[model samples]
Target: MKLKNNVLVTADWLKSHLNEPFVKVVDATYFMPGTPRDALSEWKGKRIPSAEFFDYDTRICDKPSSLPHMLPSADTFSKEVGLLGIRNEDTVIVYDTAGIFSSPRVWWMFKVMGHENVFVLDGGLPAWEHANGEIDTSEPTRVEPTNYQATFDQTRVIDKSQLLEGINNGTVNVIDVRPNERFLGLVPEPREGVRSGHMPNAVNLPFAQLLEAGKFKSAETLKMLIESALSDSKRNVASCGSGVTACILAIAAEYASGDVVTVYDGSWTEWGSDHELPIVSGK
Candidate 1:
């Protein structure tokens, strides 16, 4: 489960390595509610040659959860990924239609499942098309399922109870990657019924501040920016609307050489909606 030194790959690098036997490309596009786009249909229409569609919403989540797209059981994840023709040793490259959006979640998911060779496509599919890389509408090749089993990395993810305990004991810092307005409670949450503020004592990073047109800042720049917010404390739990954008912070933190980083799997959607949870406004 050891990861590469770098978790990002440029479009040029991926295009050149398309023919590598161990590579598996994944389209991990996901849109929030009220954003009108059918991810599955779009992938079926056109995608990077040899890329498979990872339906983050449907085929690979905790189906019984009232919350959106929570993590599935390790066995469930292993089986679904196995059905996608993924093997434990394969190198995974995940991208979303929106540059860098939602792709990091899949990358994080892979890492949590103990597959660390995965990388996010820098600037995502748009970067590939801009680079004039190959695009295909050909039917995806179906492959026989592989025997896949996942070893969950407990240190990479945190549940609601752990988050509450950490917050209460002041043993961990929480970072919310939501936009400034949402983090400050100036705007309503995109998900209806959810409150508009951040967790008590959580700091705001606004996920976008670490990117430029969907590409990440250099590791040095990222480290400096994060350090400016964190000062000296490094132990952190990341969260956002649902659980997706939280991983963006986790990935950025790792690239910045920060430690004690883990994602809150049920993020703001779960926290904000619970009236009993202590939430504060106006950072």
Candidate 2:
């Protein structure tokens, strides 16, 4: 089923518009720390035509931060995205090799940077291959850099302090998108030095529940799943391992309920490592 929200575009739609001047395709794939597959290497081997790799981990992130892929400054984002030949008016389509994995994070990043025309390519590269979309293995042609402006939207993200205040004050519903095993401290975190268990009062949603066969479920299904976890009056905060998968929840929330989710950018990486913060395990 097609995504009800305008935030996503199907592979078929992208295949037809691949050569459009106003449409800019981006490969935003990312692999976890222990994964053997390298996203950049895989992209180099095979990717959609005219696609530029957006390196969220290294090139487009806050370099000084200890956290992984923390959001870069507005100026940095504008500069880096402009270097990719993306203009403010272009219809940006982002996708990952792992279907829906890191694409939403890139899409959310664009939104956070005040780019409204950005959309995630539903089902990603796999779907494109399925649709017989043209694949380009040759080196990406360098395009002239365009002027791009970015206005950072602080309301889209929440820091540790703001999250704590919201959780303590009961003003926000903290939705943890990690697997239940990780959420309940049943398994050790992949990252060292970080503790298991979830934030106090955070509910486990498990990002997979929002997807079916690596693609987002229908809007009705998403709405049912999201509404089950959130309260009507409280704001929503999406959190996950190192703040990446949290964007899936953020997109799901917006797609389902039209409620914008304020992502906890530091997420478990920051909260779990700090001994002072409270963590709860087991239902």
Candidate 3:
């Protein structure tokens, strides 16, 4: 299906353009708290040909923040991306091992940093395998770093204070992408000290609902699901347990409805941890 914003690129497309110098593939695999897999180790074992590992968890984040993988400053983003051999003119394709999981987070990160030519791999690594794409097991070759410049777009992100203000004023529609159980506070949060409920007035639209067999559903279906949850609101904000899965919602919304959905970078990790922030349980 053709998306309005072209946010996704198929495995076949990557395979055909694999040799192009301007097309850079990235392995953005990230496992949550209890997951046993180590992203860096897996990348070293096998990955798409010429794909580099984008370590959002450690290397490319706001290291000062206690929260998980918070957005790094524009200077940090620029330097890290430049080290990945990416230039401003390159077309980046991001993917993850678990089909459509953490890849969109990197994709959204690039967008927030004002890089418009980035796309997430549709169905991720599993899709590439399905398409009979060649995999490289040899150690990655280091490419010469480029002078990548990132222009941060402030409107693409929101903090807890700004989100609260917008919610209070009835100007923003907050879409919480956590599981229904977590959104309702029926299950304990994976992170220590974080609460299990959602933000006040936040609508829960689990990220899984937007995917079918590891790939996004048709644009028509995505539009339907998002609109049903959002109702009539236009100013959208996406949030999840940490900051990662919220990006899946944001990128999918952009694909479905040609408008940008701002991500709450700290998400529940920041909101639920602080007692001052109001959280509501039970839908």
Candidate 4:
């Protein structure tokens, strides 16, 4: 509760020091494939005061890959954030429109890029508005660019090759955070030409279970759920439909066990699409 590793920040704490120097609020909102809401449009209408938009779907991804929002190179990350005037010393609070949804992806992105001070705004924008927090309808303030630098931490990310090897050998806990239907191959995938099932040795632990009314459960609850699912496996690699929701598992794993954790950047988008990767249907 006392700002654990800068993983989360309360709305009250954020508002109290809202205008402090080196504090940067980021709106890291992104909807699913068929959602009616547009995150950028909503940001233009109402958002936390002085917050900047971090477009995870488009600008922050690997543009060359056909997969959705694959992690971009460290150089690209530096250039993209530098234009937003973010510096190494800044304390970043990232939030999403759907409370605890997509913001964790941004937090994971920052951490994998070697930014340790990044945190998620607990309960996101709704919590802010509920507390009578200020919302800026006008365009966010523009700032002079900073010379941002990123030191990529390979250990924080799980590449597809590593995942495949781990799955074959059963050395790592490959956890799929998709819904039960999708995990069991009872429903079709949203993307075309992709397989219906999950990785061979993967376990399904939907990200929704870790939340209650759009907020994370207590640390004790999270630790229990994660440990029960993982058994004795200490190393965890998370994946979901397109790598967005997988980060929720990554955050929960680290917050609970403080163990070695990584997220598969391409997730099922890459695995289910490739014909060579082994996948099985039903549980």
Tens digit of per-residue lDDT, candidate 1, span 1-283: 3345678889998988888888889999998887788998899888999888898788799999999999999999999999988899998999999998899999999999999689899899899999999999877778778898899999999998888988898877888899989999999988889999999989999889889987899999898878755625545888999899889888888778845369999999999989988999996
> How do all the candidates rank in terms of lDDT, highest first?
3, 2, 1, 4
Off by over 4 Å in 2: 1-5
Which predicted model would earn the best lDDT? 3
lDDT: the better of candidates 1 and 4: 1
Q: In candidate 4, what are the lDDT values of residues 1-283, reduced to their tens digit?
A: 1245637778898999789878888999999888889888899898998888999799988999888888899999999999888998898899998889999999999999998888888799988888788889986667788999999999889888988888888787888999989988999999998899989878999999998877888878998888866746546788898988888877877777775468898899899999999998996
- Candidate 1 error regions (>4 Å): 1-4, 231-234, 258-260
**Tens-digit lDDT track of model 3 for 172-269:** 99999999999999999989999879888889899999999999998889999988766455578999989899998888888898768899999999
Worst 10 residues of 4 by lDDT: 1-10
Global lDDT scores for all candidate models: 0.88, 0.90, 0.91, 0.86
Please give, for residues 8-63, the per-residue lDDT of candidate 2 as tens digits. Answer: 88999998777889999999999988788888887888899989999999889999
Pairs that collide, model 3? none
Q: Is candidate 1 or candidate 2 better by TM-score?
A: 2
Error of 2 at 8 (Å): 0.8
Q: Which residue pairs show collisions in model 2?
A: none
Worst 10 residues of 3 by lDDT: 1-10
lDDT of 1: 0.88
Superposed on all Cα atoms, the candidates' RMSDs to the truth, in angstroms, are: 1.7, 2.2, 2.0, 1.8
